[model samples]
Target: MNSPDDTHESTVCPGCRAVLPSSRWPETPKYNASPECAEVAGELLGFEVENAARLGYLHQLRIDAYGGQHVSPDAPRIGPVFALNGLYMFLERGSGNLDVRTAHGIMANSYDDWPRLVPPDRVGELTAYDVLIAGGVDEVESALLKWARQVWESWPDDIRETIRELTVELVPERYFRR
Candidate 1:
């Protein structure tokens, strides 16, 4: 962990209780050891798990999704864009780390499990914006699935078919033509 003086110390991971003495960077999630724990970390932070498994691949996919050319000095980065109750999300880490924005921003990203405790329907006061801001191809697929589900049984046949075609574009080679 980092202190105001730029000194570091061993800190316990909130998700797995691991001592992150050698973490590459301070504020990096403790669940780096396993995909499942990574998911839990996001869950504990009131964020949805997007592209948890095979994160390295997810990182590449995010870069490809954003149209990349030159890679940064740092290797891979995990900028999982997690939605808060099927709504707004922290889009990306961008350069380094994120800030605690409008109390909602900090509250939404905090380690406290407050959002999960509140029923999604009861929180009508919170404005919901429908933007995927997918961080990777898999995340994009998941978003499409979610959108389809919301419009299912009522949406036009052509729109549903269009979404299906888009999803097909990202299917891995091994899963293609099935």
Candidate 2:
């Protein structure tokens, strides 16, 4: 068995698969090569995959999303994307645009477009962006759909319009540079 002081090299960070290792725990065989990966693991976000196929998918997605070609591949890190009952939701920001990853695919929206309202049957399809529109992105509601649909739908059309008009995309400055 490898001793606690032994260091092993992993081709990729096991957590976020950020393509490099940052540091390994002192007494563990596991290695973390990227800060983002370390955070995901440190936070106990849980294993994303246990097989090479899924690992490949994760790596490809990271490359496809952010190019992963800068001084740090997948640098700056994506904000937390939450999942409930296996239904995952995340917001992707680009140059002057934002997209929400749904069960279907990534749907792009203008920096200022309103939700257009999900179907009644799809009320559960609340992305964090919906909460961001109704209140603040930093504010996360556990009853996510209730806040997005119940409170938001009850508001007047004018209020929704005002929100859409006033809201701005929260893309980080590094995104523009990429």
Candidate 3:
């Protein structure tokens, strides 16, 4: 067995398929995660939590973007749907006005019959590594937004239309005027 101190060559994440350094942790089967990708995700989560004050409004956006990219059929169906809708609210709506509680309620109520979504073959080129490497708050925020946009656009055309339809159906009309 490889010890935590042992270093190995790069491995690919099963979720986003990003080539990443081998994780110190041994690989164990997960729904849509691998050791390396999980390690990077942990690092990004740490950064977001540590710098939540500096991250401000972008915190949820970053989380949703990452979640959207890493979805799996074995996971809760709401994961991808919620992430996509969150991205749509923030990116397409031009204002992050969709209340989280309202969105959650809508999803819980309306999405029970929705079919499970298959993750795209390619999520996005940028990963959490890109945001983590950005030196300062401004740089990190920029990187995070860029990554979110790319991930949002990476979904299939039909899936994106579903996101739009869901948003229009669930969100309050007033939120869209802005």
What TM-score, over all chains together, does every model reach? 0.18, 0.18, 0.84
Query: For each candidate, how many residue pairs have backbone atoms clashing (under 3 Å)?
Result: 0, 4, 0
Instruction: Write the residue-wise lDDT of candidate 3 on 63-170 in tens digits.
Output: 788788888767777778888888887888764524543675666776575657777888888887778878787888899999999999999989989888877877
Residue 68 displacement in candidate 3 (angstroms)? 1.2
Predict model 2's lDDT versus the native: 0.27
Residue 31 of candidate 1: its Cα lDDT? Answer: 20
* Full-model lDDT, candidate 1: 0.27
In candidate 1, residue 157 scores what lDDT? Answer: 48
Instruction: Indicate the worst ten consecutive residues by lDDT in candidate 3.
Output: 95-104
Clashing pairs for predicted structure model 1, backbone only: none
Order of the predicted models by TM-score, top scorer first: 3, 2, 1
Root-mean-square deviation of every model: 17.9, 16.4, 3.1
lDDT: which candidate is best?
3
Off by over 4 Å in 3: 1-4, 25-31, 95-98, 174-177
TM-score of 1: 0.18
CA lDDT scores, all candidates in order: 0.27, 0.27, 0.75
